[model samples]
Target chain A: MQFQPADVVARASFRLPAADSAEAAVRTCRPLQDELRPLAVEARAAGPDEPGEGFTVEFLLKLPAPQSDDVEGVLRTAAAPLLARLGLDAGKLDVDVEDRDAIVWAGDEALSKGGTACGAYVVHLRIGRDPDEPHELLPEGSLTDEEARALTETLNSLFEQRPVEEH
Target chain B: MSTPAWWDELMSVSDALAAADRAEVAYWRGGAEDGREDSHEDDVPPVTLRLAALGREFASHAHELTAEQQHRFLGVLEDVLRTGSEADGTAVATGFFESLLNAWNGGFDLQAAWAGVGAESQACCLDLNQFWGIESPEWMLPRVA
Candidate 1:
């Protein structure tokens, strides 16, 4: 059977020295999401109580199965120019497609597990993905050469953490 | 003791904007883990400095807030950050005030959802980065705790 455009989920994690550094990273990443907005039916921003630090961002990109190979390929291509501009490393890049689900939920559900205000405000797809015959576009794996190089550079500054300030 | 009317009003507006921003971003990100304060610094618009100031004012008065008052304070905080600025700021502000018209009409425990701050009341704080199928910030795992 031919693949349809909808079964792709991109979940990525980032580590910075401190929460503030993470915030900077997210800001840097926003343009990436904005660029994908037209291509993907949905896009969003999610993280825990703190804005920066160690955060995980997840977004669903809808792509045709014929272009399934292009899913990761596109990300790899996208990562290069962007990461290069930001000066981050591609080798240390942490990106992949971990699951195949019909509907992709924005934000991590784990935060709410402890009865905390951890609800990062999960953003639903601006457009929902089809459940039946969902097309799983990208699978978790290594990024292309360019992606690797760019990610390694981005990581150099993006993940460098700082001390959390006392409230 | 009664909190100042102006303080209450400021709290209400600040909370509304913050919650709205938070909800909208989360919705867009597709339910990714969020809680770190650092993540928001970039996402928030420059105008948000106004709201942040209000948040600071609210925090300063934290000592004066009752348990219920504090809960209400935190409850709206989530909303302001999640959905406030993305939507029409003026409209959101108006809705917040309108909701407060009968703020106590049918509700008293709006605080239930936001009872406290810190880890117990917050989402997971992120300190690491992963992308391009590789994880970085080698110090992240050890620092998380």
Candidate 2:
């Protein structure tokens, strides 16, 4: 991850970490590289997203084939196995899938509390890697600097923080 | 104003779908609490397919809907987002909102259709990308609080 300036705004398409639990997720939930499987899916860090050796994980929503009932239930079910397989919990890390081609971001801990999980096609949280990337995380040009910092700080901390477990 | 027949059918199906969604969420919640790893996949999962069916039906007549009807269509979904469970919100967004939003993109005045709803619903429209990557127009984007 590149060094982030305070003014850098992140325009992500997935649910960001809740302002409250972001620090906790970063510190407690983030697993070491060995903990997670090798990121085999193609990286979606396009259009100014530089992966910088960081990885992107594809959250595939495994639903009961052909049954379209309780999507949230299905996502919840799919997320636990997937997240558990990755050693992530719903609080610090839970899975929620959007519609077709959408994968609930493993980085999204905000709605993991009580809300249903939501996702993107592929999650590449290039939050602050590049400075000029105008964000759409919020509305066009509507994110106050304070909101931007609060959001990016959590995401930046996701990669920058050390994994104490590995040590 | 009196509602259109097709709109009524859509609303009826949506209500049924919402109830099924709640039941399904509860069922999964129960299963999770029981500590079972997909013990019930044997039963047919119908929500995803049902939504696709609704989409096809909605699309067939979606272009004919008036802006007022659009308001009503979105209003029901908006209410679900507001009053339903978190699971319900996700369900409506994924199932109904995604379907209707796609139909709107094909050709309906979403802004005009969204006119009757409150700022909250309008904001919901703007946040489609947050759900499954439904990109909203620059004009439809709301000012974040």
What TM-score, over all chains together, does every model reach? 0.28, 0.31
Candidate 2, after superposition: displacement of residue A40 in Å? Answer: 28
Q: What value of lDDT does candidate 1 attain over all alpha carbons?
A: 0.35
The residue-by-residue lDDT of candidate 1 on B1-145, one tens digit each, is 1111233444464454445545544544445437444454233222222333334334444455667666565555445535544322322222232122123224522233223532311331111123112243233233364
Candidate 1: deviation at residue A31, Å? 1.8
DockQ (Cα-based) per candidate? Answer: 0.02, 0.01
TM-score of chain B of each: 0.31, 0.50
Q: What's the alpha carbon RMSD for model 2? A: 19.7
lDDT of 1 by residue, A1-167 (tens): 12234333232223222223222333444654565432211112233553333433333334323234444454444444433333344443333433223121223333233111321222211112422334444334778988878777988878888889999
lDDT of 2 by residue, A16-46 (tens): 2331111122122223212332211111211
In each prediction, how many residue pairs overlap at the backbone (N, C-alpha, C within less than 3 A)?
109, 12
Best by TM-score: 2
Q: Can you give the lDDT of residue A28 in candidate 1? A: 42
